[model samples]
Target: MIGGFGMWELLIVLLIVLVIFGANKLPEIGSGMGRAIRNFKKATGEPEEIDVTPENEKKKEEGEKKE
Candidate 1:
């Protein structure tokens, strides 16, 4: 086993992710992961949620339009 994962097992998983998302998109995936965890914590009543709301959704749409 390598790093507690069987040799080549992690490589296989990473290859699958690369095939699915491509290398150029990995940073976008990581940022999305951060956003998902932040939202989950806020839903569970964490001290901060970064303001998730329908209003935020509307604002997002508006922001996209402005771009």
Candidate 2:
């Protein structure tokens, strides 16, 4: 029941996300979440940090180009 989204509620939420993002952008969203989580851990002074994969690196690069 996190954020008013329960287990089955999450599946319904995911379906909405799938409709909005489509299959192509879904992978990008997942990777972006991973990088955000990594950066968050670093900012919080967590001893262990997760590495962002190459796919995430490419997505970040694309976003920077748009700025």
Candidate 3:
């Protein structure tokens, strides 16, 4: 059991999430959660190097490079 949650307990929580958010929205939720985690780590001074660029800015740079 990780973090005091047994396998069955974790499964139940996941089921609840699936019901509430549905499968289509799960990926979006996961990505947003991943971004939040990365930001939290950066804020704590644990990782000295990180890419802080917004997605649109990166896409713009790529477009300019290709032109």
Candidate 4:
């Protein structure tokens, strides 16, 4: 068993996914998940640099109107 999943079990799960999403879309799904994981890891290592809120947006709009 690999990671508590037998080969047959893994194959069956893959077949079900293939039936649901079809063979055509698997690469797209895989790449999107890969990107999401990469971005999540990158975000974890960085400090948040800005906050944008409704109040801040309104103030900026007002300032722009005055200018």
> What lDDT tens digits, residue by residue, belong to model 1 across residues 8-67?
898898899999999999999999999999999878885554656688798899999999
TM-score of each: 0.50, 0.59, 0.66, 0.57
Candidate 2 clash pair list: none
Q: Across residues 9-64, which tens digit of lDDT does each residue of candidate 2 receive?
A: 99998999999989899999999999999999878896566766698898998899
lDDT string for model 3 (1-67, tens) is 9999999999999999999999999999999999999999878977667799999999999999999
In model 3, what are the clashing residue pairs, if there are any? none
Candidate 4 lDDT over 1-67, as tens digits, reads: 9999999999999999999999999999899999999999999989878655689888998999999
Cα lDDT listed for each candidate = 0.88, 0.91, 0.96, 0.94
Cα deviation of 42 in candidate 1 (Å)?
1.2
Model 4 residue 40 distance off true place after TM-score fit, in angstroms: 1.1
Model 1 pairs in collision:
none
Ranking by lDDT: 3, 4, 2, 1
Identify the leading candidate in terms of TM-score. Answer: 3
In model 3, the Cα lDDT at residue 13 comes to 96
Whose lDDT is greatest here? 3
Q: Rank the models by TM-score, top first.
A: 3, 2, 4, 1
